[model samples]
Target: MTKLPSVSVVILNWNGLNYLQQFLPSVFASTYPNLRIIVGDNASTDSSVEFIRANYPQIEVITNDNNYGFAGGYNKVLDQIDSDYFILLNSDVEVQPQWIQPVIDLMESDAQIATAQPKILSYKEKDKFEHAGAAGGFLDMFGYPFCRGRIFDSVESDNGQYDDVKEIFWASGAALFIKRDKWIEVGGLDADFFAHMEEIDLCWRLKNNGYKVIYCPDSVVYHVGGGTLDSENPFKTYLNFRNNLFLIQKNLSFFHASIIIFIRLWLDLVSLLKFLYDGRPKHARAINKAHTAFLKAIFKTGKKASKISTARFNGTALVNKSIVWQYFVQKKKTFNSL
Candidate 1:
């Protein structure tokens, strides 16, 4: 019998007592031997720690002093876990009993595969792919992240078209599986990222370091998207726009970053106008705020990105074309269209 590597499934919770209650059972039922399940509580005021302690006594709980957001919180907790691999699972995800084995098998086959994500379908609409990460995440020429089965808001139905094992530009953080050493080598998630697009930035760094990020469709999970923050929340809007700029600036070449940032600002302006036109001033303001924060961050992040080794892989994994143009101008909604 082959001895499986030690696996730790760490769920970061932030006032998600209900979600944990609803989803923890399925996670507990995971069939992977040599598995350790842990919940890292991000200073929840709602007694989430107490609830987990009482109900799931067998599960390990690590509590942070305050809410360090997603990136920082996970970094703090993951530092203590000395496992072979760590699955940075969202509190809201519901995993199948056998989800861990297939992903582990795939990772074991390729030592260079530093990060991987399973097919993420919607918890509500089980047949449809979810928003955060569908099949696997990829980037456009301009640094927009989209999935193989999801483009912008148009999520494709799961027909197993993307079931093949292959390399991808990024893996979704919703249910990310990463080698413990590889994750530590890249310095884990960038704490500066706070939350949004942090995983993409980490994966980009992993690629720059000559590692692979892949999609393993054999393992699947259901994610209840927007559990911590809803899409309409202005703060979420601000984070998405702001973090996206930081992502590209910190990874791409200076020439590419400058040009793409300029273009993205203009596109953001159009989105702001659209928001105002739709009588949603809050959203418009959020976009405005994101730009302001991004501009302020440019100098600091620009210097840092330049210092990092930019040994990029010339691969077809990245879409050389503009996904925005493909989706809006040509009205190509599905992943197969482009």
Candidate 2:
């Protein structure tokens, strides 16, 4: 029998104690042996702490005084993780009993893989695919997120659409597994991200170092989309709108980053015009603010690229070329409507 590697599963919670109602049982059902569960709770006033204490008494729980966003909150547990592998899962997701075994099996078979994710399905319909991630997350050259079965707003229902395991550009943080030390060596997630796009940033760095990222389609799970932000909220729109630029700026080479930046700016302007047409000027303003935030972050990190010791992939800068062809030349953008 293969020796199953031990895993420390970290679920970051920001005010979603109730999500725990649906999530914890499914997590406990993980069929993989030698597993430990830890919940990292951000400063939430919603009885989250009480829920954990009352229910999962034997399970370890860590608490913060304020919402550190996803990246910040997960960083806390990352510092303390000493297991063979570390798993980062969203509070809003429900995992299958057999989820982690295949992920760990694939990683053990290939030490080159730095991260792996399960096939993610929809929490609402169960047979449908989720919004954030499905069969592994891929990035357009412009840094927009799409998956094999899930383009923009349309999730290809689990009609065996993405049944194969394959290499991908990034793994969704929604249900991600990675070796613990590699995560620390890669510096974990960049806290400056506050929340969005941090997983792709880490996965990008992982791939840059000649490490592979895989999608283990056999390990399936259900995800309730958008647990924290309202689906139609303008703030969510702004974050999705601008964080693409942040990921591209931080990861891509200067020339490629510049090209993507220009393209993203143009797209944002068009999106703003669309928002204006839809009588949602507030969303347009939010997009403007997101852009401002990216500019501010760029000015702050511009001198710090060399300090980013994790980025070892300076080869052809693959993302730029792929994104340009898919979104610009091919004009086959997915997920814009979602």
Candidate 3:
């Protein structure tokens, strides 16, 4: 029998004591043979480190002095780990006993696959797909990412529509799996992103380097969406808007990036006005801050980190049509529609 490659499952935690207490046991119960479970603590003041050492003494806990957010926190913890594959799991995810095996097998079968994500279902609504990553992640022509089971805020019920394993544009960070060497080679997640869209950025770099990102629906996990940062937080808004601009600038060609960024800025202004009209001043301000930060990011980092030889987009995960127009104007809500 062939020996399984070592898999390191690292869960980044920041003041997630309740989530850890509730969900860590499900991880411990995972049936993978060659697994190393770790809780990389982001300097929680809630004695979460102490609790881990006390109750889950067998599991390794890599504690940082301060909260490095998601991107930096994973970069720090992963540097010390030596493994064939790494699963950057979120603290609030609950896994089944056989969750890791199918994904591992699929990835092992294809060395070209740099990253893969399991089918992410909602922890709250068990029958429906999660917002973070539904069946798999896909990018629109404008670099806006939506999932097979989720378009904008509309999440589809899982009726076995996306059960087939396939290539994807981006794998969700909630339960992201990547090869160790490939992750380090592509500079891992860009620390500048801080949090949101960092995974998509990483996957884009991997794809540029001639590797594929995929979805393995056979392996599934449930995510309690927005565990660290609430979805409604204006700060989340700032990160999404700012980091998406960074994503386009960093990956797409100069001509393509310029066009998309210009269009996105206009769309964002509309979103800001809608927020203000809805009496959400904080969200409006966040969008304004995002635009300012985006300008700074472009000027500060003039060069692309992951430069590719191709002149245009090569990945199958991108939807050439405008998802915004299809959803808003045409009233096509599901992924199958457009």
Candidate 4:
């Protein structure tokens, strides 16, 4: 028999036992034969660790003592990854039977491609695309995520627009594949992010190093969307807020970063005033933390660090625009118009 290419699937869990109920069965059922699944449990107090230990004997489980959050939990298995490809899948996602090989096939064909993601559909609203990622992910000059088939909050239904394989700004960390060495090369996901935007940070570094991120729509999966964290929850808000800012700090050049930061700050103020006007003080916590975290991160990353390039590309792709603000406004308009 010909030797199949080795692939390691890394699933990070943090008190996500409920998610595993739907996730593990789907993953271990993959059609690919050359596979190793590693479940990194971030010290869940729930029976998540035990459930996996008892039911999924084949899964290699790494149980940490405390919750390292997303970055820390994933970093636990970096030293243990020994495969051609490392798939960083969220515990909440359930993969289709043949998802892995199609992605692997695409990577096999392209030497320049370093990362890839599949078309993610929503499990709850079966006809809808999930919020976090859809098809392939991209970064605006301002560091906001826009996938080829998705724009901000408007995740268009799988309308065959993403059938073609092509380059992208980033791949969704939810069901993403990256070359093992490339993951190690860019230092994996930024630990500073702690949760959201880490994959964007990784892809930016990959692109900076002259590698391409791709969306392979043939690799399909259904995401429950909010599994371990509620979409409206405060910590999710904080992480999403803080991490997006941290990503800008790590990647953009000083002048470019400043423009993006100021735009975000001004929009956030508009959000706060709108919230207060609507008497929704409860929702302000996330935006408030987003506001403060950026300020602190700006101070910590240092004004001088903006001159640094985390990775080197043959070309410097810079833009003059407020990517997040424009996209969010458009997203709102799209949502309202719908």
Off by over 4 Å in 4: 303-338
Q: Of models 1 and 4, which has the larger TM-score? A: 1
Each candidate: how many clashes? 0, 7, 0, 0
Q: Can you write out model 3's per-residue Cα lDDT over 197-306, one digit (the tens) per residue?
A: 99998988888777888999999899998997897899999999999999988887778889999999999999999999999999999999999998977865446633
- Highest-scoring model, lDDT: 1
lDDT of 2: 0.79
Instruction: Put down candidate 4 lDDT per residue, 142-184, tens digits, no spaces.
Output: 5666655456556677667667776767778889899998888
lDDT of 1 by residue, 1-338 (tens): 88899999999999998999899999999999899999998999997899888998999999999999999999999999999999999999999999999999999998888999999999999999999989999899889999999999999999988889979989999999999999988899988879989999999888888889989999999999899889988889889989999998998888888899999999889999999999989999999998888888878998879876866553537889999999999999988889
Report lDDT (CA) for all predictions.
Answer: 0.91, 0.79, 0.91, 0.76
Off by over 4 Å in 3: 305-313
* RMSD in order of candidates: 1.1, 3.0, 1.3, 3.2
User: Which parts of model 2 are misplaced by more than 4 Å?
Assistant: 308-338
Deviation in Å, model 1, residue 243 alpha carbon = 0.3
Q: lDDT score, residue 61, model 4? A: 90
